[model samples]
Target: MGNENSLREQKILSYTGFAAKANKIVYGKRGLRNYIRSFQRKKVILIPKDTGSRVKLDVIKHCQIFDVPYIELNYTKSDLAKTLGKQNISVVGITDENIIEGILKTIQ
Candidate 1:
């Protein structure tokens, strides 16, 4: 069971990396908010478990307004930063439907 959980986490990280490479992901609070407001594409927002309450609340509010789906991942900010090759990435928004689907599957 532990191995299965680790494999699932790896798969989620892999999808995050692929999305970053494909330029289908937006990081940071402002960037994600802008992407949500400006982009009409289907998106899913990933909020790390360790995100601050204010930022997480704001993100959830924006997502609600935009009717975008969001999920809280078991990973932390550092985990996401490492996976996406970015620094201090607390919020990640994925704009690609296929990649969103892949991530959703892994998380579920």
Candidate 2:
């Protein structure tokens, strides 16, 4: 069971990396908010576990306003940053519907 969970986590991270490589994701708090405001194509917002309450609340509010789904990842900010091949990324907005579905399924 532990191995299965680990594999599932790896798959989620893999998809996140793919989304970044495909340019279907937006990173950073400001960038995510801006993407949510301007892009109707946003499918899901990924918030890492280490995100601050203030930023998380703001991101949740935006998700509510835009009718976009969001998931709080089990990973930390550094884990997410490493997966996305970036740095200090707390919030990520996924614009591709297919990738969103894949991630949602994996996490669920």
Candidate 3:
């Protein structure tokens, strides 16, 4: 999932293995997280933690049109590599919402 095209679009998502790493580790902002959650299964859905060039056209369209910045973060998995295995991704999302949740939820 390490492609320049995906990197330009979203941050690489690292699998935060079995430790509920998303809500706890990555995200620390409540307001931002709640806002992002609202978009879930609605106007916008959180991209998988490892969204590569495989992103869908509609998601890409929304990200481009809305300027929402499709993003990810490999740190979540890296930090917990001993638990979740090593992630190949390098880039991850900024601490807005998606990455935060992924980090907290990603187990290790």
Candidate 4:
């Protein structure tokens, strides 16, 4: 079970890396808020476990209001940031349809 979980995490990390490279991901709290508000495309917001409760609540509320889906990752903010080659990323919104589909499929 542990090994399976690790593999899933690895796959998610790989997809996140690809999204970052393709410019399909919106980073930071402000960016995610703006993207979810203005964009009508299929997207999945990745909120790491280490994110502050207040920020997480606000993000979730926005997602609910906009009918967007979000995932609270088991990984921490630093882990996610390192995967995307960034620093101090609190939230991430993936805008690519293919990546969104791929991640949702993996989760289920």
- Candidate 2 per-residue lDDT, tens place, 1-108, comes to 877777777787788899999988887767787788875663778888899999999999998998888878778989989988888888888877888889779867
TM-score of every model versus the real structure: 0.82, 0.81, 0.26, 0.89
* Shift of residue 8 alpha carbon in model 2, Å: 4.2
After best superposition, candidate 1 residue 50: deviation in angstroms?
Answer: 0.6
Residue 34 of model 4: what lDDT? 87
Query: What is the C-alpha local distance difference test score of candidate 4?
Result: 0.87
Cα error of candidate 3 at position 76, Å: 16
Clashes of each: 0, 0, 24, 0
List ranges where model 4 is wrong by over 4 Å. Answer: none
Candidate 3 local lDDT, 1-56, one digit each (tens):
35654443332233323223443222223433443444533222234444445443
Candidate 1 lDDT over residue span 22-106, tens digit each: 9888877678888778666677888889999999999999989988888777789999998888898899888778998887787
Query: What ranges in model 1 sit over 4 Å off?
Result: 1-8
lDDT of 2: 0.83
Q: Rate the local accuracy (lDDT) of all candidates.
A: 0.85, 0.83, 0.37, 0.87
Superposed on all Cα atoms, the candidates' RMSDs to the truth, in angstroms, are 2.2, 2.3, 11.0, 1.5
Q: What is the C-alpha local distance difference test score of candidate 1?
A: 0.85
Clashes in model 4: which pairs? none
Q: Kindly report the root-mean-square deviation of model 3 from the true structure over all alpha carbons.
A: 11.0
**Could you tell me how far off, in angstroms, the CA of residue 89 lies in candidate 1 after the best superposition?**
0.7
